[model samples]
Target: MQVRLEQVTKTFAGSKNTQATAVKELDVTIASGKLVGLLGPSGCGKSTTLFMIAGIHDVSEGHIYFGDHDVTALPSDKRGVGIVFQNYALYPHLTVWDNIAFPLLNAKEMKKRLKQRFAELSPPMANFKAYIQRLVEEAAKLVELTAYLDRKPAELSGGQQQRVAIARAIVKNPSILLLDEPLSNLDARLRVQTRDEIKRIQKQTGITTVFVTHDQDEALSICDEVIILKDGVLQQQGPPQEVYDHPANQFVAEFLGSPQINLVGGSIKANKLYLGNEEWFALPESLSDQPVNIGVRYENIRPDRENRKQAFEATVTSIARTGGTSTVQVRLADGQPMRLHRDSDDVLQEGDRVRLYARPRTVYIFNAEGEKILQC
Candidate 1:
């Protein structure tokens, strides 16, 4: 199902008779059978947005359409969306098979809804047991949990338990799947492996999915399109790399990149962009002279001794090495700190003074109000 939100707003009544908007007018469309990520920091309304789509939270204004059907007033259970909570929410006493089939057994309301949705394919009430058993087995196989069908939640690993939770969500053949921070409980190594599994399952099932996560790497790695939010407002929505490469504003540019993008304080004077009181780059003669934030990505920064005349000087302060890559942190001549990712084999002492240069065409400029002035 294609999920679309049109000017969907969510508000909460706060203390002292005031109101706080958890999600502002959000207009977004998730294509059929696509996995999309709602990404942002804590208290950014990402989870609230997911809840609104799940029909758990009623919108303050506007409507939600599930492939042209207005499901704005539908109850969560009636919306045909399966929600997997952050903690996985598996029952400790139940075996893997039972846990997956639990939703089916207790789905009194779902039976009525599903019968109406698929009237021609609906089986008789007496055949419901066989139907549910088939669904449980199919879901278990889909998530590769058939081998551990009889194992309890405690017997399985964190990743395995997560897969069982996913199986339970899909057993009902939901119109859309809603996962809220489902990978946050796993270990680092397992998190990576499980995210890949989630992506694989999504592609195999071809079920439209909305995944909520605060981790940028998780979103960028698995999602087709990532929607970034800030303070209840939509910042940007596009393919992961597109949003990363070309951010809409300073917040997105800084939030999307690892180690964050370096924002050097700059001033425009007499058609010259000056950094740390030194003329850094040339600006247009017609542009007004004002303050600007120069954004330089880590990958764009490189050690350049030959370009001393135009390079910025900085002293190596620290280095973090992992695998074949190293992250180097340095303090500029003006005492501003900067960080960059480079080859792990770079032979440089912590106190060594080096000249740094950024790819001129990749540099980004933002105005004092945090709007993008130039992005190349």
Candidate 2:
């Protein structure tokens, strides 16, 4: 099902009628049968956006549409969306079958939809009891929980419990699936395993899925397109690598990378990019001479064993070892700390001075107001 939001806004009243906007006038269309991710940091309106789609939070203004139906004022029960929360929200004492079947047993919306479906079936079939059993069985199979159907929640591993939660959410065959940080509870290895499983299940189900997460890697890896948010405003939305390479703003460039993008004070003087009096890169003619921030990814900076003259130089401040790669933090001449990506094979210690240069066509120049000037 296709879901679209038009000029959607949500506000909460503070202590004295002062309101805080949790979600601004946001407009996004989730295509039919696609997995889209809502990614951002804490309190960036990602969860608020998901909640509004689920009809748990009413919009302060504007409308929400499920395909052609305007469901702006619909209650949560009537939205036909299944939400799997971070906690997994399973009943400790109930078996997996019971947990997966609970939604089908209690949902009025499901009953209403099933009634409509029943009337449309050929020969006016009356196998209602058998249909529910098929739903439970199918949901379990989707999450690879066919063998653990009789086990309790506590008796299963963390990954198993999460699978049960997913099975429970999808059992009713919701029109749209809302997953809010669904894999945050599992360990690193289990998270990747379950993430792949989710992608597979989503492909088979073909439901419009909205996955909310703060992890950039998770969103980039599992989503077809990622919508980035910051401070109640939609920053950018596109395929992960598209947004990563060509960030719309400084916040997005810094927020999406692993070691974070480096921001250094630079100036465009006489059509040349100047970093602390060194002419390292050239600026485009479209961008006027002005002060700017040079955004460089960690991998774009390389340490030179032979200290080349006329190159941007810095003194090594610290080194952080993470597996095979090392993060070398260096202090520029202006005292600003810059980080470089280096492998373990390089022998560079703290307090060692090294000459470095920015990779060509791999840096971004943003104006003083944090707007993009150009990227080269």
- Write one digit per residue (lDDT tens) for candidate 1, span 1-376: 9999999899999999999999999999999999999999999999999999998888999899999999999988888888899999899999999999887767888777655544455454445566677778999999998899999999999999999999999988998999999999999999999999999999999999999999999999999999999988899999999999888999899998887998888877887777777777675445578888888899888898577555778899998888778889999878888898776556777999988887567787788777665544
lDDT of 2 by residue, 7-101 (tens): 99999999887999999999898999999999999999999999999999999998999999999999998888999999999998899999999
TM-score, model 1 to reference? 0.93
Q: Candidate 2 — number of clashing residue pairs?
A: 1
For every candidate in turn, the CA RMSD to the true structure comes to 2.3, 2.1
Superposition error at 217 for model 1 (Å) = 0.7
Off by over 4 Å in 1: 113-126, 283-286
Candidate 2 Cα lDDT to native: 0.88
